[model samples]
Each structure stands twice: as structure tokens, then as C-alpha cells.
Target: MKLEPHYLKYLAETQDKDYILLDLMANYGNDVWNFAYFLTRSSDAADDLSQDVFLSVYDRIYSFRGECTMKSWILTITRNKSLNYLKKQLIRKILPVKTVPHGGTVQSAESQLFDRMETKRIWSAVIQLPRKFREVVILDAHYGLTDKEIAELLNISQGTVKSRLHRARTKITVILETDNEGE
Candidate 1:
């Protein structure tokens, strides 16, 4: 019988303990946080969701069968947690709110202006997409996951992923064009 790699053997050996799991969480913390932030668009919510995702990963790590990279597996968990958080917020009518303080000077006003404009353009287009299409766009564009990876993560067919991505791109383009027409 051939032996597995040292890391996999180590992982399998220590997979049951909380500290080892904490190490995994620490290693992947930033990746998970960034993914959540991209999905939620709120720093506070993203932070909380990242923690929830790590908890879920810790609980479910034993179920990992090495079919996908650990990072992909963790991302799948993060995506699910983010969507669940969004759904709960909608149910509670606690949608994310951004507040600007009065009389506060923003450093680099010109850059801030550019950022605001770009964000408006991008989010306006994205917001027009239906949930299924928007999710694929977010996961692919923001998180840089391949279509096959997304299909596995989403448990959907590759054709479905491609279709949704195509629809999302067309919707975004239409929204941008309409905005340009108004301008």
C-alpha cells in the first residue's frame, strides 16, 4: 500500500481537534474574510460571516473527502454562510446601511470620488442581475474561481454555470449601456 502525502496524513491525524482546526482557520482567515466581504459588501457583516464560515468548516472538515482543494471546500462553506446571512438580513429587514458622518473631511477627495463613481457603476449593473446569475458573477469575478470550480462549489452543472455567467454579463452590459444613454 502506498502512503499519502505528509500534510494529508497530518491533517487526517489531527482533524478532530479544535486547535488544529484553529490553525487552519488562522491560515485561511483572510481568504474567507475577503470572500465574505465581496458577497456582503459590509465590513462588519463580512467579519461576522467569516467567523461563522470558519465555525462551519471546523464542524464539517471531517466530511471532506479530498475531492477538492481545501481552499475550494472552505470557499463553498463561506459562500453558503454569506447567502444565509443575506437571507436572514432580508427577512429581518435589516439590510446593510452605510452612513456618512457630517463635517468629516475625507482624505484624497479626488480618489474617493473616483472610487464612488466606479462602485456605483459596478454595483448598479450587478444589482440588476437575478440572484442565481449575480452569484456566479460574484464568485467568478470577485473571487476568481473557474467555472468548473464554481460548478462544484455550487453543485450545479457546468452548462448551468456558463449560462448564468453569460446572462449576468449581458445584464450588466445592458444596465451600463442604459446608464450611459441617460448620461
Candidate 2:
């Protein structure tokens, strides 16, 4: 997407202003939400996280140095927010292992059923991976982010991203193939 000069000027010069920040959020909101959804595996959680990311972006817009595109910056925020949310969920699950309720009661019954059938089989396999590997898989396969972009967002080396992604794909592939054999 070509950045309009006026937009660039506004971002570069007046990004601290609320209206400019709101404009940026409006333009990139859907993209951020999609990225968050791909990471979270829940549309409702993605919606909440996307809103949080945009709020963070709005507050931090003036800190942008144009080192990367606005999309990348926004995606970085989305990734961080999603990761934080995942960590919180994991902690909650771990802490309440005995107390947490487990049953077949789902608020979105229709959507849950559809999700079970239509969900990417590979993603279910991917989730079985350790967190680091799962992250690489989600960023690469699910979100279509390049290794360089993933590295930039995750603040890691490109080689690390490549290795993790390779390992993740192999693990997920094995899981899927094994499941297929059992079925």
C-alpha cells in the first residue's frame, strides 16, 4: 500500500495528535484483528486483544520512528498482546487445574460446532507443540509472516525463527499423519 504524503506527514509530524492516531487505528484495525484471530484461535478473544492492541498503538504512536512500516508496528503490538493473553490463559489453567470447570457447556454452540469441523486440522496439531515452536508455526503458516518479519516482531534472529519454524512444521506434520493413520 502506497503511503499518502499527507498521511506520512501526519504520522511523522503530528502522530501525537489523537485524530491522527485514530485515523491510523481505523485504517489498520481489521488487519490487526485478523492477525490476532489467527494467533488466538478464538474470535471473541481476538476481538478483545485487537482492541487492546489498538489502544496500545494509539498511546504509543508518537514513539514510532518509521524504522518499519505502520503495518509491521501494528502487527508487533498485536503479536505481543496475543502472546500476553496466551500466557495469562496458561497461568490461569495451571493455577486452577483442580477448580476449573470442565463440561460441554459452550456459549456459542453453533459456532463451536462449526469451528470443530472447519478448523484447520494442522492448527490443532500445531497447538500440541511447545510454546516456542507453536509461536513460530502460527506466525509462519497461519499468519503468513516471513521469517524476517517474525524475527523482527519477536525480537529474535532470523536463523532462530527459521529453525523453530522448521521444527514446528515437522512436529505438526508428524502429529497429523499419525492421527490420520489411527483414524
Candidate 3:
């Protein structure tokens, strides 16, 4: 796979730690926060996790080896941080909190309402999935990561990523179908 142009720039500018950190945050801050929010389903946790991920990146920037795209590497850190945050919450036996989805201004009211409802329904099904399935689904569908990138990010085989994505989609289909039947 080809490396991101910014990744090459990032590699070349590692000496200017502030510039690298700022550039990384400017480029990937949204991706990191969104991934964290999707994983934890909490804006507050996402915020905290985003901060932690960036700080970790800031501290460990030198350790980057270019084995993957810089975005993939950053997202890998995000995934790891999110999982750890969830684990700690689990260990504490604290219930996870839900976050409100953001709204858009451009669409007509009815169109926006229907769009929100559909998006909520689909995400509800996705949220109910097992973590492994959820991870692959969010990585593949939300982030549009290639199977190879996801496999590398999650440290799974490419076939496993494909399998999990298939199963996730199938489970989501079943869930939506059941919901429709009820309606």
C-alpha cells in the first residue's frame, strides 16, 4: 500500500517535535476523536481518550517505525486507548454512558429527521454487536479502512477482518430486520 504524503512529511520532520505534534493533531484529531467516540459511545470519554492518545503520540513519536501509514498508526493508538478505557471502566463496574449525535443544518427538517432516525437505527444495531464485530464494522464502514490496514491496526489476519466484517453486517441486518418486523 502507498503511504500518505503527510506521513512522509511527518517522518521527515520528527526533529521539530512541536511542529510534528501540531501537524498530527491538525490532520488527525477528528479521526481520533470519532473513533474513540464510536468505540466508547461517550463524548466525554472520547475527549479524554483523544487527549491521551495525542499525548502518548507526542511522547512516543520517535518510536514510530513507518511499518504502516501514520494515520493507521495513530488510529492504532486510538483503538488501543479506547479498549483500555473500556477495560478500566469494566473493571470498575461502571456503566458506559451514551452520547447525543451531532446535527446538521443544511438538510430540510423532514429529511434530516429521517436521516437521523435511520442513522440512529443502524448505529444502534452496530452498538449492540460484540466488540470484535463492532471494531471491524466501525473500522471498515465508518473509517473506510482497507482490510489489510484494519488487520494491521488490530493485529489480526486479513481473512479474519473479512470474516468479522461479514458477520457484523449479517448481524446488523438481522437486527434491523427484527426491528422492522416489530414496527
Ranking by lDDT: 3, 1, 2
The best candidate by lDDT is 3
Candidates in order: C-alpha RMSD to true structure: 6.6, 8.1, 3.2
For 82-178, candidate 3 gives per-residue lDDT tens digits of 9999888863222333333565568888987777788878888888888899889988877788999999999999999999999999999999999
Best by TM-score: 3
Worst 10 residues of 1 by lDDT: 92-101
Give the distance in Å from residue 125's predicted Cα in candidate 1 to where it truly belongs. 2.5
* Candidate 2 lDDT score relative to the true structure: 0.71
The 10-residue segment of model 2 with minimum total lDDT is 92-101
Which pairs of residues have clashing backbones in candidate 3? none
Off by over 4 Å in 1: 1-9, 13-23, 91-120
Query: Clash number for model 3?
Result: 0
Superior candidate under lDDT, 2 versus 3: 3
